[model samples]
Target: MGDVVEMTSELGFKYSILASGSTGNSFYLETPEKKILVDAGLSGKKITSLLAEIDRDPSDLDAILVTHEHKDHIHGVGVLARKYGMDIYANEKTWQIMDSKNMLGKVDNSQKHIFSRGKLLTFGDIDIESFGVSHDAINPQFYRFMKDGKSFVMLTDTGYVSDRMAGLIENADGYLIESNHDIEILRAGSYPWSTKQRILSDQGHLCNEDGADAMIRTIGNKTKKIYLGHLSKENNIKELAYMTMENQLARADFGVGTDFKIFVTSPDTATPLTDI
Candidate 1:
């Protein structure tokens, strides 16, 4: 009898932050067979140019997934979807909230896919799982994407990381997590008491220490990269966030550039593409 042979191709995934931080948020993800966008917080013009910078065409995107209807996350969605004829996916409540606010202008109902918490959506060669997160939005959710055996998790804009969130992030190959503010600086700064309280609450954004704690708990030997994101313009500095996260991880016996790679994204400008 002749020997039988089976052939399989290795899967590849690549990601880049088109923009990050409170000023705006956008991320680009590409696998061998799909191109996906996480958010469109930047202006349409900027998003288009950023795609060019990364050697990708806006029209080539397979889909645009929205985490919430916050202005910083939906600012450019209308223009980008209209121009590229791309479909958008969000939860039913999120879509309803967006429509009530006229956030994305007039998107076709047929083009909007309503996703619910705990459901998995498939696109091209990737599978995406959306789970609820603590954020001030109509049913806010974070994403976990898996292709072949590699997985990536993106958790941002949450005030605190719950056990459920940590469970989702465990053993991820790549992570884009929030490190929004310094609690002491925010408390002493000029912002109103109400705003500060909101930011520090469970539904608000994560502070540096909180973010670092989450990273230390979730990171594993398979975690290849971590990008600190959504820094506050007033209370947080890039250096402070980076140093805090690095120091905390060191206490846990993980060193940056040795145990894993780390990077920071800016509110403006696209970060270089990273392959996983």
Candidate 2:
């Protein structure tokens, strides 16, 4: 994606996707005092290049936060952390799963702060609130980050939006929500029945309609940016997902690009830095 300049000059939370979607998932979040990485799904080389693209280096990251133990989320976590000597933070279940699978590199256990569901944890200048998301994992959690009076929520790998998740995401300045698939397309596509069922199950990925519905329910006046992420390459298209969300938001009296900026992140490359 091309760089989109910020229209507003005011300083706020800055976010960038080093990579997103099925190929890989990584994000960089910058507060006034801390620079953090949300995931490291991409390769170490790719992550380094993406950081350089944004005029940053791997050593600059204060910490690397993981959402789950999925390969797509932890592909380069070990490499990056070992290279930069950065900490990896996640919930106890996540850490346990990773440890059981021998996925972590050599690092200080104290640095691997185990986050609790619905509890707030402070890391540098950012306060992170992680909650359980509907996904097939030992303990997959979505995150809500607050810093400098601005808040943003990042929710992906979710199958359905629970009322609790909606409440947590509402009224944020930015949202990185999943728009994983188109149900009809997925159904008609040539996949095994069991595989398709898993994709449609409550523990699977969210459909486009589900995502749009959640956006309508949770978005507030303070929501300034919305990025549709983790889209399926086979079952969904960027234009279709964008149009679906745009039309749905229109019905809710919110105009895209006017009420809030809309962006789509790539699974293989870094998206432009977005500042709220």
Candidate 3:
């Protein structure tokens, strides 16, 4: 938005989602001195190529943070970390569970870091808070990254947002929230009943209705942008997801473009780098 407030009061962090969906998921976060990735779901080669799209060097990454052990979230974590010699952080239970399953192949012990939920972590000038999320995976978390006075949250793969989740991310300047499916489209599609039920379940994914409602509740007055993400290719179209959220904002008397901005992420490619 031309007149909407940006990070004028303080320094803002850089953010971009390399991919977000059933196929893969990743987000890149950078402050002035630190560059980090959240999840390496795509192949290592593909991840690097996406980095090249933004003129970023994978070798320069400072760390990799995993949300969970799902293949779509961790498929490339081991390969990328080993190649770049960077450390990775995950909850201890997730780390132990993933390690036992041979998910990441053989990362060195030193490369593995454990961060408990509800703790404040610092990397350079960046401040991160990892809060528990309602996902099926063991010890899943959604992250909010802050630098200076601005913050953004990379939130996905959660079945629902709890009061705590809403509280943790309500003040972010930007949000990458999951808008996984359209309920009507999903129910009318050809998927089996069980698959549909699973997705509709609390531990499955967030539908467009719930996602939009969450966005409406969580955004602070100064929140600048909201990116609808993790859409299902089979059930949800990007336009539908975007419009659903936009309509919600409009219904609340908020100007969609002038008061705030919105973007949708693709399953196939990375979104343009976002300045928070």
Cα RMSD of all models vs. native, in order, equals 2.1, 5.8, 4.9
Q: How well does candidate 2 score on lDDT at residue 225?
A: 87
- Clashes (backbone N, CA, C under 3 Å), per candidate, total 1, 1, 0
Task: State how far residue 100 of model 3 sits from its true place (Å).
Answer: 0.7
lDDT of 3: 0.89
lDDT of 1 at 208: 92
For candidate 1, which ten residues in a row score worst on lDDT?
4-13
Candidate 2 accuracy as TM-score: 0.93
Models sorted by TM-score, best on top: 1, 3, 2
Q: What lDDT score goes with residue 104 in model 1? A: 96
TM-score of 1: 0.95
Off by over 4 Å in 3: 1-10
Give Cα-based local distance difference scores for all models: 0.88, 0.86, 0.89
On residues 50-112, what C-alpha lDDT tens digit does candidate 3 reach at each position?
898888989999999999999999999999988999999999999989988999999999999
Deviation from native of the Cα of residue 258 in model 3, angstroms? 0.9
- What C-alpha lDDT, on a 0 to 100 scale, does residue 27 get in candidate 1? 91
